[model samples]
Target chain A: MSSLKKSFNVRCRDFIHAGEASISVQQLLKQMHIDPVLIRRIAICGYEGEMNVVMHGGDGIYCVEINTDRIVLDISDKGPGIADIAKAMEKGFSTASDEYREMGFGAGMGLPNMKKNADEMIVESEPGCGTRVRMSFIIKQSTPT
Target chain B: MVPEYISFVEKFCTGCSQCVRVCPTKTIRIRNNKAVFFDELCIGCGECTRVCPEGAVSSSISVIEPCMKDKLNVVIVSPVLYAQFPGVMPSDVLIGLNEMGFDHAIDLSYYLEMFQYAVDEFVLENRKSNNAPWPLISPICPVVIRLIVLNYPNLLDHILPLRRPVSLLGDEIREKLSHEHGVDKKDIIIYHITPCHAKVVPDRSGLMDELGFIDRALGINRIYPGLKQKLEQVKELELSLFPNEHFSFVPSTRGPLWGMSGGEIAGMRIDNVIAVSGVKETMAYLEKIEMGLFSDMEYIEFRACTEGCLGGPLTAVDRYMAKSTVQKFIKMFGIGRRLPRHKIRQLYDKGWFFSRIKPSELAGVYKSKRKPLTFDDMKKIEKLMSLIHGSDCGACGAPDCKTFAEDVVTEAADLKACFKMKE
Candidate 1:
């Protein structure tokens, strides 16, 4: 098989289970016996995406595709999209309300952290049309078994 | 290596997956109408033994026989044994242990007290350096150590590297007995009387191999009948062997407390500590620690058994009664110290209280063992998963629907095994 995909539903402001999706994805990759380094990257970026959906998105779907050579994460949400993707991509530029701040999150590091951790990142948003963030990580070349 | 303390009896197992569901490591799986164990992944926590309705799981506890010519037998009693028999005096147990044909029976409470001191000093040293990871995890529970070594390698650095109290006591007793008897060190056999099954696994480090300090570890359940008989004998004779310091090491007031949950932290006098018991709760705590949730915490004590060592599968008494008995015993005698802090400090500074284990090297092997899921297999698994009812009811002899689906796709299970599918 070329690839396998799994999708998770992220409800907005569900702080009770904020990182549940990322954990599930992480566990799945672990069960697959992926390299620890790759699993760590996936966990960090996936959790950042999951937290973003719970904190900012009205509703979202987090999809992970695992391929022989690479893994892909696509986070799409129905919410007030970022008008200036460039500005929101900067570190410490979050627009989170006081409640989010009180929960020790929304420091504006989510997008930047994801971008820094992933091999490549893509962002698209239409202010009111919602936003979609996609990230791809190259599976490190392995010595042939 | 994963220890072989807990054995699965295939004949008695019904493939209920009760042990599978309760296994924190997910090492037990149902295949061919039987529960199979991945020994490398098992931590020997005895959770399987606890949940096996068919009585299929049993632990390999040590059984000490009488010493032959030139062999010196010494029994190192578990601190938890004091809590095993209700209304039984601590001295009575020691006397009973002696009556079992062992030359000497030593209480571990003294070693436990020393261990507490060592722990406090180690934590304080870490606090001063501020270099080690936060929330230093306790390594007293062999099962917890195995869990971390197998599953949580990253947190290995956070585990306090001290040797178990019993190991230290084993070393000391062997040396003392050999010297006093003018006998070869090999002639002295030290057997640890234990309440936990995990203790039966030999400490296979080079030092342990060389010294053979603790030759065997026997569960209290194995000796409880003999001990009960001995206790009756002592009561009938009205033996006046209280504080048998001449015959054996009397436990200091605080060490036996290590038998219960939170006892280690309380004994160490640590200010900020979180004590969690039971395999599930310990695993959850570990996950949270992995997520950096307990960064502000100082210490975490994770015991595999529900009520700590007292709740071990090999333990003879109910956990609550044991806890109360321990408390009452401590109250009746009150607290006393066998050695001064300065002496404990001397031992700590001499580096005699810690394990020489290179945790990363030893535990690092358990990683990279997860089987890779092929893309074709993944698709089939996903398709099968989607077709199944998502209740995760575990009625199909697998832990959940997803696992059952995977098993079916892999030809390890049949599709008709699903009740919903039959409907």
Candidate 2:
């Protein structure tokens, strides 16, 4: 039942530092002897989630919890929350602006890509309060061929 | 052939560990007050050749001699040769090479045009094939191919199984000359004049083995002095005729551009191609590819040098200036010639484009095992990590604090080794 945890502060609109948190998490996962395939899933999920925070969220905190059995990521932001959760979760649905798109991101695929990579995803939001996303990945019994 | 393309000249080596710090593969190590290079771990990227301030590192190439009188020597020149001098054209360089003892000199761009057609058809067919891997990596750069085979063996199938243009050209020239001159193939020695040190390495094993026709590699820098002298001697000759083109040796518009960075991607006609150059950047990109981060990409062109072949450590010209010179050549006479697509397809179907990259013995040797730290070991490492400043200053001789902590656990070093902590 022992667990290891780390938290990273992600500032909104910090485009330069957008992928820094995900890269840091990736290095940490590699150091922890996690399966490479599992690490990749976490990296993609962490990256998409981190980018969402940088592009849309106000100041936010990205946290990670890992144990022998599973890995979890908790991303919470103080930004305006989505009104239609179903629509936001749609594959091509995006609220990101043209400026973000110009930076080769915000293709409306972040949330869906995150969902595809993670084993399970939970989203909670309030209209003007904030948005929080928790993603969980189960440790696989064997490496996928 | 020498076992290694690069070696440490111990007389000048100061054991500064600069090469170890920059090596992507961690092949260089400080041992007994000198640098020891592990050939098995080296990818031959020439990063060590560039970083060695004491001139301790030398890239070995076969020396050219006019004394090999029994054999007809033909030099296959890279486009980087044209980029070397300010006003010199590729034609001038080739003519000078001829004056310097070569029976004839030809450009690799000629074969590159043929190669591009092969690539276009391969990509189109590969998409429809049942199990062909997407994001086919270009195998043009030997160093990049070696890096993948040695480090990312899983992506080995992803590489385009096409013989390098230079090697393909060797086969072509040897065959054509044997028929045209009524000479034996062995009597015709085809030398590749290259800017890259990696190009000189004869494949003893692995994917690029059995390129027997490519007799030797002569470095552009090694031949610079002799070529310069020949250039002076050939100053009165008409350089505009393009002698090689008269013999049907010419390249397409994009052929010469392959010598510069981003050129291969520009030539790839496919969308979502990732072109990366320089050792460190290519290493990072390869890691991403290994992680499946670039699954959406259709192709990747990885070059070890900063600006492709033009930025190779064995080059005589500055990379920036060389790139501009190549661009100027493209503007004037770049559209030399191209074989028709049908003709190229015929060659492709004949299996001329096919090549193999065998897995390296070093592949997965270091990465397959994921060493899980015990609870006690983690606690010990955490304690050691906490005692030092978190800044990743390399004063401890390790790359960073985490590696330092890992070294402490492995009993390779101690905490007092951190000079920053001592301060």
Candidate 3:
């Protein structure tokens, strides 16, 4: 089966345009007549990843791949990478500054929420290097009502 | 079958594509030098009717004389109807309807009070139990509900499941008037005096069609001339002539305000309610809600009309003037009656106010049968997008270049329709 791939850029500290990428992806999925439940889950993951990049990571790239069987999202940021991925994955363990926390951006639940929504998630990071997050959502095959 | 509330008169349409630009759902397209309406995509916000400069888009106004002659006609006056005539009070409008050859006229504000109470209770209980979706949406506007059904299906569970005040009032009038007048249930016809065209479709189709509460809807503008004359006559009468009991019952302070934006939430005791009006604003807010935003809000009231029902397409006067009139009437009437908490609770317990609106029922009969786009289709659309100017000029009939490209790729439109491409 043929797959459609799309990419969006997320700039660090650009609060005004942070959610633009996720919203565009959501609209695209809606136009394709994807199941709303699946679209919403994917949107939440996209938004969380986008926000995380803006709040903590450097300028990032968010990409999505869609096919009949499943949809996948890949997000990478060119920022100071996480030193301990295991501790960062834990809920409420945030490295965000006081300013970001005050703005309600760095809630430390980003990775956990993304993991909950995605069928499979893989995070690759190294100190002094950038971070990459990959998430996949299985599309249920059903007759369109 | 979905009732055709809004119709396009081809003779009057100049193919300027004005209606196409304002359509919220992008359902209207210029085809064969005329605008074609796709009924399935329509949410009946009446935006097209409002924007059509040539008056080509007309809302269907039923001829009520036949029903009046055959049945015991009872007119349910919308609060917006009272607001139309500047100096006319709600009671005056009711009297005017009676003078204009109606068996009885009921004030919608009375039921609106009960509707408010029911919603308040529903929100409170839902908050305590955490059983349903948070930030429950108001069910007052039929167009808003239809919008959710068509574009925001994921937010369906957020809609408050309650019958409109008009339906509640219609049910009571039909049941009581038929018995009191010794007429058959079918012999008693209830007509809703509506200010909006969107209200016309729900009575005959959609989730409330099976209830059959409202027999027909009379647009305010259609009946305004005769009703205004009747109200003028009522205005000339002495103020003290009517007996004390006749003017004893009045709607609550906040009920009449339901004709304007932010009125529904004003009546509720809850503090976390947000009221949004206008079709575009409502759609944007719904999109935000779908993205899991606004979690703290307990309720949201959305009106498809810009300034609420006062700004309805069928309104007789300016929306601002109508709003001022309603406000003046409210102030003069002196914060009218309030339903007792016990009474409201009893009705709530009996399930008198609840409406069973299934998701399937809200999904209109004409569900779009278009297949989901494949990767190849997407590629074709992208290619078409690159070939055309993205200025979003309505000369191509579609709202924007993206929609035009999609239409062309889907074979719904000819690629040559793009004026830029021809050049």
Candidate 4:
């Protein structure tokens, strides 16, 4: 309901401090009195894409924008692009290194989780170039808890 | 304590880890590429502020800048802190504190011994009244009280009626200092050495629009540097190791533990008195309340952090170490149960001590915190939370994205606290 929008920038693919960005977006959605279901979706997808950038892309920037009617997320990477977009979307599929898997990430659930939470998700990648992800969730006016 | 009190400077803040290393509670956090204070975790020990060479970190103070006009400052420290020195007499800290700026210092816990009975009575009366809110929560901790007021308004009535430490002591300080000494209320400002910032913030806010009885709240971390420095330099007077000032004062490990987690509930020896040890545990219990579950408990001691006041952000020692310190101190001097009720009554009957100093303030449930969240609003919040998945991962600048979102919706918080919502 406020005219002003609250915002922050997430550094590309910094695994050590990865989730910090998604947490902020979830809090912003909460301030808008948006539904938890909506927040949860945004979080799942945001986290998914965020991890993807870290593991696959090396380093990338992520951005989130929230409004009463809808929530938008944009994750951009300057690292190597996705070799194959279709192969990456498969459930339980990951190209993450051994280090990433050891940290409980890169079990191939990242893309799936993002797809599950967001109402709309788009991924574009060019080999040797970076990859970008944009996701959106539509907010319902009233939902019973 | 006066020179050692916590002071904050917004400028000259460089993200340095010096203060964090020196902190006893580890309450200082570097979230969102900057320092974020975990209030529930801070004990007002003045350690971090003292260690901050740049003086960028600040805590609430009685006097503001440009007018560091020193006055006849008095302090009222809680009893638990008396456990700090194992060998010294309480008078040593008192004498040392007096030399600092207090000019006069008195123990507020002396009044608390009598008030415990009052608390017991208050709980008993509420238990007998079926109309009272079920699982009546204790109101002794100012931090918990304010947490409820700022975030959980629906459960406001559930708060038990008890005098806060500083408020009760505030009345006594005002009376003893101004009335007895022919000093004006404005002139005789009493600073309460807060265990955490919870007390420090509201005390500065004048809390609930009520005039603050205690002039300022000095945290342990904020004062640690100044006091430690003073102690090092002022070798002239051997710092007294005795913690309890009076022979009547019982400040053994058990006595000090009275303020720790589950201490009050255990003290009451009442049935259904639940003591939530940490924020996560407390939130779970609060969740039980949200499920429409009628908590039939009589007294609940809700601690925001893992260790009780001992784990406060301000203290100069680690909680486990402090607990061990307290344990060793208790073993050295056996002080088990509270002083006899009669003795407490006698102290109360006589003017030598009084308990309820005008019962000035009460902490609210939901809307009382710096940023507030409510039970009814959570449904809307859950909707938002459901969108994010249940991972409370603090990627958001806030402790969690969902909570940050709730705070923002209520206009109690900013979107900057969250990563998911960051632009």
What is the Cα-based lDDT of residue B258 in candidate 2? 83
Q: Which model scores highest in DockQ?
A: 3
Give RMSD (Å) of candidate 2 vs. truth.
Answer: 4.2
lDDT by residue (B136-209, candidate 4, tens digit) is: 76666555554444333334567654455456667766776676668677887767665564564543212322
By DockQ rank, best first, the candidates go 3, 1, 2, 4
TM-score of every candidate: 0.85, 0.84, 0.92, 0.54
Better of 2 and 4 by DockQ: 2
Question: What does candidate 1's lDDT look like per residue over A1-145, in tens digits?
Answer: 4777889999998988877777777777766666656776777788888888888888999999988788999999998988999999999999999987887877888899898889999999988888899999988775112
User: Which 10 consecutive positions of candidate 2 chain A have the poorest summed lDDT?
Assistant: A136-145
Top-scoring candidate (TM-score)? 3
True lDDT of residue B19, candidate 2: 74
What CAPRI-style quality would you assign to candidate 2? Answer: incorrect
Q: What local lDDT does model 2 show for residue A2?
A: 60
> Model 3: how far is A49 from its true place, Å?
2.0
Weakest ten-residue segment in model 1 chain B by summed lDDT: B203-212
lDDT of 2 by residue, B119-232 (tens): 778887877673556677888887887777655565667787777777777777898887878888889987877888777466533454425867788788888888888888
Which prediction has the highest lDDT against the true structure? 3
Docking class of 1: acceptable
Worst 10 residues of 4 chain B by lDDT: B359-368
Superposed Cα RMSD, model 3: 2.8
Give TM-score values for chain A, per-prediction. 0.94, 0.94, 0.96, 0.86
In candidate 3, residue B364 scores what lDDT? 39
Alpha-carbon local distance difference test for all models: 0.77, 0.74, 0.79, 0.57
